[model samples]
Target chain A: SSHATGYNSNRILAPYSVYKGKAAFSLTPSLPTFTKLHSGAVVVDRRGSIMVIFMHAIGDRKYDWENRQRFALSATEVGSLLTMGPQDSCEFFHDPSIKSSNAGQVRKSLSIKPHANSNGYFMNLTVVNNLLNTKEFFSVPVTAAEFAVMKTACSFALPHIMGWDKMTHQQSTGGTVGLQS
Target chain B: SSHATGYNSNRILAPYSVYKGKAAFSLTPSLPTFTKLHSGAVVVDRRGSIMVIFMHAIGDRKYDWENRQRFALSATEVGSLLTMGPQDSCEFFHDPSIKSSNAGQVRKSLSIKPHANSNGYFMNLTVVNNLLNTKEFFSVPVTAAEFAVMKTACSFALPHIMGWDKMTHQQSTGGTVGLQS
Candidate 1:
């Protein structure tokens, strides 16, 4: 029954975009939000733009809703991360479209680096808003397990976004998205 | 010199716990924060706590600072997830210490479930604060690659947290932390 799928069953029935192939794995990292939980996904949209989508829930328990926001990264942007070193922090979202305006938001910078605290080392995400002035939003944490998934997802999604059609089942020499041999 | 390690070199030098067997992999997921980039780590601390630590940067980037936070889960908590299905939302952080108080914060429920949007399917993280009145905070998304790493990290970190000593290099029958053979 559709009811077995929980709170999101209704949304699945909606006119959401149909994705081909299968998204094999994903993880929801724990965040330090005082109120709600945060989630995300990576998909190659119909336009073939590799998008990292995030869902932020707002309002009170009485009336709750989500603000679905995302940023598209080019194939080059996603590919660069494949070679990212421990000491390196790569800024990928330089697209001016990010500044299309979410409350005077000029630039949103997303960088992935290894971070540590008194507890231990972590995979750190540093996202900052370079508006007229820089204001920080939130910093979330993911487990080492989750980080591996992210890297693999990028590798899997890369071939899709780079115009490698899998449905016809023909391999494209130009669309190999993996560790270079 | 340690200066080559970037902003976290100082933390690495501090008396923070020394982790053996090398964490090998970690990732910082892209978060939808108005201000800061959030990062996380997976480690078996000195006390053997399988901690998922997160750093949330606050204040201004000029006088910027971070609030280092984390939650520890038992081997059982980590193991239960190995079998989690698409429809399951497993609540892992039932630890009462989470209520130790960061401004009247009570039960913080951390759940992992698959979520979807007009974009595509996402590995959803639903972290809700069950305080006096329910307040929704942030729902962050992770790519499929990142999520796969999370699961593998759990498989890796679980043995360490479950009293599987590696320095001496002897396998234990009770310390298996992977899929059932």
Candidate 2:
């Protein structure tokens, strides 16, 4: 295929230029660069974006840290996590009939419960792939103190992005969420 | 508190009875009973509802099957699982500001990937409870043949409840999803 010259590529650009035949240079600003507020498998960045990491395991070999997986969460999702209960679980699924195989038949679920020794909690991850007959499993643990810190950091993080003033106020005052009835 | 007599319980029902003081009798039907299509950890029932079970473990003691947990899924959720890809993940979270603590601060996620040696796939489940500082993790595996059967059964199950004729037709003919672009 022959390449079209700038003049012939888009004849519509033939007018409104400072030069006779040159198109005006329009500079596109680069995307924003995010600074790290914290860095790890699970931490909230300065931009309030969160990253959660988990690992995969086979039948008897449960330690598969080499195959670490990371997922990002939005501000609202963080807020939801900060308020969820131990037994409550949520499901997310996409319409599988779409053309994109990657998005098809996808279902992801999450639930959390206490660590038996009362030391910490484990985050449960369940992944299923019907097309390939595959399922990946992971259990990531965070200590109780770590969870408290994460919750505090997350509350601050979301108000930075979502401007939930009431939430921030409640946290600052060390009061229960007044938004709840 | 004084108990109201049948005649006084509902003054609005004082009229249109077989007798002046007697109200017409009506029977309330019992709710439908569900028969088990298949029993055990994970199976679809005759009612088209699906049951998924996962066990919890504490620290190094991974075989905690005695504390097995069960979750029910609607027909549509089963269909979504049948078409999901190995890498795709979905999230479900509820609003935290709700008055009900049980329904608050909940986040659940599910994803899937292939098991080692191609024996099967592992379903990854992640559940978080920000309020209790707890999380639960579980990874369930299903062999390739089992997955295929589940997919077929799920495809049939949804159409039974959802009346998705196109989906059932495509599955019956062993045809690629005609609904896909």
Candidate 3:
């Protein structure tokens, strides 16, 4: 129970700092200065050195899923947001209104249309997050077609991974999942 | 390139020793004492402090996919197997012929029928590996229904995990997976 609780807490609490030279970011608004955002959940990347936190607000926990503007913030930007307080809104946009003297230095952000399905929203959020976070963005822009392909790939990979985990667990526990021993 | 190579090598080389107080096990037969067997791979469980190695023969790395008899070996049994030289064959079974007077003391093992599909085999292998490695196995037996659900959950979790990794990697490399600035 401790292990399970600990694992769950770790998953929900903050960004896992498994690798060195990376800044640790907290997802939960536990700090005194921190205020709760509209985002229901925050996802952290554990596989790589650069930690990414994807935050999106889902208005209600049950039924009526409405996604607010999603923000993909760096460690420094996150810290700034925390200090700015919850009352002040911080919007990330790729709009021309947000101008820079040098066009090359302009920051461009991606936006995903809100979906009625939670699964669709999660998948799209993941795809867009991946696209924005990748180094390839500087060289190649993610097209709508590529986004669709990535989403499809993520959808496909999900079942395989789960199936593998389930079968493995069943074997370990000596339980039959329709597989003859 | 280093990251990709490292990740691939880690996946194929040895069982991940993510927990403490568990014996480290190698899946590959790189040891001089190791004898090439018909089995394809081995899976280890971290929670129960047990290790199971499944071996299958790929033959010429092209066509032949013969499934050898699957064996689930404990840590002590694994040690004994390692001590076994290439000239000797290690046989693991729950055969009644190999009798032990004390039934309770007898080590139990699970077996799976051979599948023609490599993807199925790999998925099963991964599932079993994770099941054996988790902390929950010490307390609860994973049920067939639970296994199905867990597999489904894992399936969904995989793409998110992979997508996060890809994004993190791209960000680290400063390459675009296609977000315009």
Candidate 4:
């Protein structure tokens, strides 16, 4: 708890000056600011860095059923009003608004690593928040067309993504992924 | 903001005096303590009650790579490992550890949801995290075997669930879903 006297980019630094003392020789920066420091015995690129999340929302817990899936717990229920929620499958995507003038359209992507280990066959059909009392509502069914698009996208997809519960691969692209070694 | 100074779950209960509350229903025996909780939520079968989460470390940050992908960050550098890190595709199957005590295979089923969004063309690799540091490390070109399996599964698997992304009347299925359904 004792202060190390005058600080050098660290010590009493505002938030993340990222300075180390005589005993420490390594620095792992989570933010963009600390990338310049290289003081420690830690190997370069050896430790896993924290990823910056940009998707609007990942793995929405939505109801996959028609407009009816939102209200009741089961799809086969009374008439409903709210829209179903998103799926449990994890997703990664970029917001058009968040795009920098430099990145171009490169960052627009979504990935869902859903909890495929449960009975929520159609992840999009599974509700995350109760959704009954809020404005957040979306849906994705394993059998829905968009879901099929996602399914095909996941299956025959360029990187060959996997789906819940099976060996199925999603491939919805009209062409092939071009990459060499 | 207020408290009834008597019996509380966390604190010690009195020896003889019984504690009563305004709420009619109470924990019968008492709620079992859990170690962890998920960031998201999932509704129960029919009841308004939501399912509780305990072991959530596995799927902690699965697709949490969206924003990070903007800088074209690689998976090898990230902290903590992903399930099926950067494989062309991840194979899905039941853990096979649990036995017949469970009925629906969903309880035992497991699969990887591969990540590959090409921005609609010329997909990029190295952003996926299927299983960090394993044979699946870094993305690979989709293989012939994977291609064959996906094509067969998509083309002939479920005609009922195809070709509906850009149209109106969504695809529908009546009976239970089979392999491709």
Candidate 5:
């Protein structure tokens, strides 16, 4: 079926993917005076492959919610596989839109322990490391130089000038008001 | 200011960005019979530095909208830079969500002539070539192997598996009914 070959087939695990890994960092508050929710997981395949890791944070206001999803990879695994070179490092952030004043607020957070069980599967650092070290036919070696070029090109291609950092101050802090003609 | 250093600054030139290049390819219908709206632009700085290019597509239904924003770099520039090696080539598709049956329908498309005007800045083959070949302090050489690894890693990091390809057929085809629950 298409799932076997599709690059995005791994998304099938989204609903249950939340249970796969332990929290990589402590949850910290960013914007004060607002309710904040933080949740994250390191998803792995049935055979213990570390498919993805993501952290999401949301700041809740009376009328709107501010959210951010930070996605990343383990540097150790990436460095070993790609020979990323000493000078190479990478970081990515995507801020798509500004929340309108009338948008409703919803908050949900998941607490996953180091050995949480999901569908009878469990994951730990050893399992993740084993998966990373495994030699797969699909594994390819990438150089640091190539990564640098692509990064530069993408930066130039997607300029995030939406003033996301200043969003918290600009959002309406008062109760919602009905629209006036 | 951070805005000056930040890679993405709204570019305020979304309207003008379109004139910076030619249509890389014809806009062919992908999901037939459904209303399709496609918009694209190649954003550049006031000094004419190519910053980014983006295209958005939406398939409308009676109650909800199925939308996608596909971000890409110029193939001509990328292909020439890496030589792509023997095993390297890239294709991107974004399937965000399925359309609900009751979503409303709307369609619009933009026409970009080869030498359209944008704030008196017109881009053609020569302009693009000049931008790519310029000796910028930020320019870096990237290899094909590195690009492949980064691509594979990103796919696993962000999985958009909502069956957007099957959205056209599944959304509410009949009249909308009030929520029964």
Candidate 6:
């Protein structure tokens, strides 16, 4: 069965002597990659910083020697791929660590065409499209100066971001990811 | 103003001689070519015998100058192109001398993707994925012998076929080229 997957992240906390101690914690947060490999074609594009809730994308990635690819599909198209039938719920994945405490966060539109072949799907702690949204979250523990540098370097090296999570149960806030049998 | 367009036919015709006489004709058809000029990405396929129906895929060639090199929609994404509004009537160039009356009596499925670039989107009579369906009345006449040769040639030339159409009409049951304004 195709299941959601993710990657690892690491950061060093520099030493800054406080009056009595060094104040700080550097984020080496675990992030998710935009696309994981299956041998086909890969198209990557980054939209401006903005959040989206309009369309929902659900997927299954099973590792099999014979099968290696992700077929792009819209929500409706994915529904057709459903073998469990309508109304059935299944476990799925979503990266919520970056979700804004407020829903108004504009995560710029970022889309990628991950086909059957790819070297490796990489990810950072932020969404590639919305530099602003990524900054807002990064600035929480990191300084503006540190955020800027990290964003740029990480983006160039690891552009694809978003951890894959498993959805055990889904509530119809508007859309659902899994099919329940 | 109308000129370059292509047709995709999904039907069965009797192009064989012996039992058929005059008015029956068959022309060896070619495969269609699909490509996006900007990307230089190309794909090709083949299909059954298609009646070429038009005589002047010229003016439908949309251009103010002879220096033009391609169609506006050709090799472009459909989302960027206008949605094919309701148009039942279309125009095609007819060359009866080509004589393809009893063209393909065999079962055939023709599919054409509109030339997003050129005005006259005459389909290159190829098998492809973009095709939705086609009309019957507007087909060109071809002989049964010609149909056989055409089909065999098409099957052989599958890879060379570029998905292109010189006709510019949506297939429909209505005999009219388009609805009256």
* Reference-based lDDT, each prediction: 0.38, 0.41, 0.28, 0.22, 0.23, 0.24
Write model 2 residue lDDT over A1-181, tens digit each, in one string.
2122221221111000011111111100011112223342212223333445455544453434465544445565666767855444333333334577566665555445677765445566565767768776656565443444344434433443442432344355545644465
Writing each residue's lDDT as its tens digit, candidate 1 over B41-120 gives 12223334445433322333221113233445555456555434445445654434444655435444455556554221
Q: Write the per-residue lDDT of candidate 5 for residues A7-102, one digit (tens) a residue.
A: 223211111122112222211111111112343321111111112333222223121113222222222332332333333333222211227442
Supply the TM-score for candidate 4. Answer: 0.17
All models, DockQ values? 0.02, 0.01, 0.03, 0.01, 0.03, 0.01
lDDT per residue, candidate 6, B1-181, as tens digits?
1233324344334432211221122232333433323333222322212322222123443222232111111111111111122221122222222344533322222222333443222222221121334332212233334434443543332212212121101111122212221
Better of 2 and 4 by TM-score: 2
When summed lDDT is taken over every stretch of 10 residues in candidate 2 chain B, the lowest stretch is B16-25
Q: For model 4, what is the error of residue B23's alpha carbon versus the real structure, in angstroms, after optimal superposition?
A: 61
For model 4, how does the per-residue alpha-carbon lDDT over A39-133 read when each residue is reduced to its tens digit? 63212122112221111122343222222221111111101101223344443333333455534332333223333553222222222222233
What lDDT tens digits, residue by residue, belong to model 1 across residues A1-181? Answer: 5334332222111001111122111121111111112343222233344454433224232211133334556667777766664455566544344445564355455555565542111322223455546543323344433443344444544554453433233333247644376
Q: What lDDT tens digits, residue by residue, belong to model 5 across residues B1-181? A: 8687765563333221221121221111111122222222111111111122232222231111122112223222222223333433333221122174422221112111111222121111211113234321111122334334433433322111211212211111211111011
Global lDDT of model 6: 0.24
Once fitted onto the true fold, the runs of candidate 4 whose alpha carbons sit more than 4 angstroms away are A1-181, B1-86, B95-146, B149-153, B160-181
Report how far residue A24 has shifted in candidate 4, in Å: 50
Predicted complex 5: DockQ? 0.03
Model 5 residue runs over 4 Å out of place are A1-71, A74-181, B1-181
Error of 5 at A11 (Å): 10
Quality class of the docking in candidate 4, CAPRI style: incorrect
lDDT of 2 by residue, B1-181 (tens): 3354554564342111011111111111111122322221111223334545455544453444565444445433453455445443333233434577566575555545676766566665566767778887666565677556555554444433332222112212321211121
Q: What's the C-alpha lDDT at position A119 in model 1?
A: 17
Error of 2 at B130 (Å): 3.2
Candidate 1, DockQ score (0 to 1): 0.02
The TM-score values for the models, in the order shown, are 0.31, 0.28, 0.19, 0.17, 0.20, 0.18
